[model samples]
Target: MTPRLSNQMEKFYKFPDPPELAVQLRTYSVQRWPTMNHEWRKNKLASILRMKARRLASYWYAEESLSPRVDELEAILALLKLPEEVIERENLNELQALKERVARLEALLAQAGALDLGEQVDGGS
Candidate 1:
């Protein structure tokens, strides 16, 4: 067998095949599961959005500060069409606003569930 196929076979061999009835029962259970409630859905969506926004802001800041001067200048000139300092200030302000929005969402989520912001549902610290 080719190395790739051999590797895949090895991975597949790690788990025993389930009985057909077991598989059917698992599938049925999943299909019968109820949709999440509004508060749970909102909290999940807010968590995802906040994480994405923070990651994007971190990437933008890292690229702005860590790239070579020539590359940075070219990027600023080609993309921003404004002074670097102005762009940096604008980006910082936007990041700050995003953080504040996330904080507000967290507070709302906590209040909706009647849970403290620092508390976890599973009782983990």
Candidate 2:
């Protein structure tokens, strides 16, 4: 019998994957690395994580106490909860502003394309 699996994944898997949504991020990662360097970067990150684990273990077992800055940051994170309504309101406001700016810029770009290139001004299309 042929085993069936989800088509969400390819027959041959790829590593160090960024989703299709991160279109520009994929390009930036490829540009940063040489050919086959993506695999190397993934391995390097794993090694660094292990090293950090060791450091954290050592720190935890040490007799030394927490630094004031670290303690303060922990407290701040714990205490920083916001109301859901406030967060939703803030997000909606930001999104509306972004949409407005995009609409205005798109309008200007369309106007500029309709005119001579050299005659376009910053404030007016």
Candidate 3:
């Protein structure tokens, strides 16, 4: 073997497989259950899983899309309630933070069927 070729060969060494590894590989290949049923059950299961994933994703997105103004009422809560990534990305200022807090409160109020903002009150004097 030439010195240059021997020096290059040193970088890549072919690993010798153990006897047990070879036996395991052979058995695994033969026992592998790769065949799957191409029927409606699998299709239904896949569709259900897909819908579940979409629902979960929508929930996450809903939680994330908040008004920054309502977020800063309680100094501690605003920080605690913020998602990890958002907190890491940037610090919320006073105005935006306040918006977030207000938004959250509004959401709760709306859920409780109170704090009617859309109604115009009139004094019939």
Strongest candidate by lDDT: 1
lDDT of 2 by residue, 39-59 (tens): 453343225334343333332
What is candidate 3's lDDT per residue for 3-81, written digit by digit as tens? 9999766533332123332243233223321243323323432253343433323322333442222112132233234
Looking at model 1, report the run of 10 residues with the lowest lDDT sum: 67-76
Give candidate 1's whole-model lDDT.
0.44
Per-residue CA lDDT of candidate 1, range 45-81, in tens?
3343343433323323343343223332333224323
Please, what is the TM-score per model?
0.29, 0.34, 0.18
Sorted on TM-score, best first, the list reads 2, 1, 3
**Between candidates 2 and 3, which one is better according to lDDT?**
2
lDDT values of the candidates?
0.44, 0.42, 0.39
lDDT, residue 12, candidate 1: 39
What pairs collide in candidate 1? Answer: none
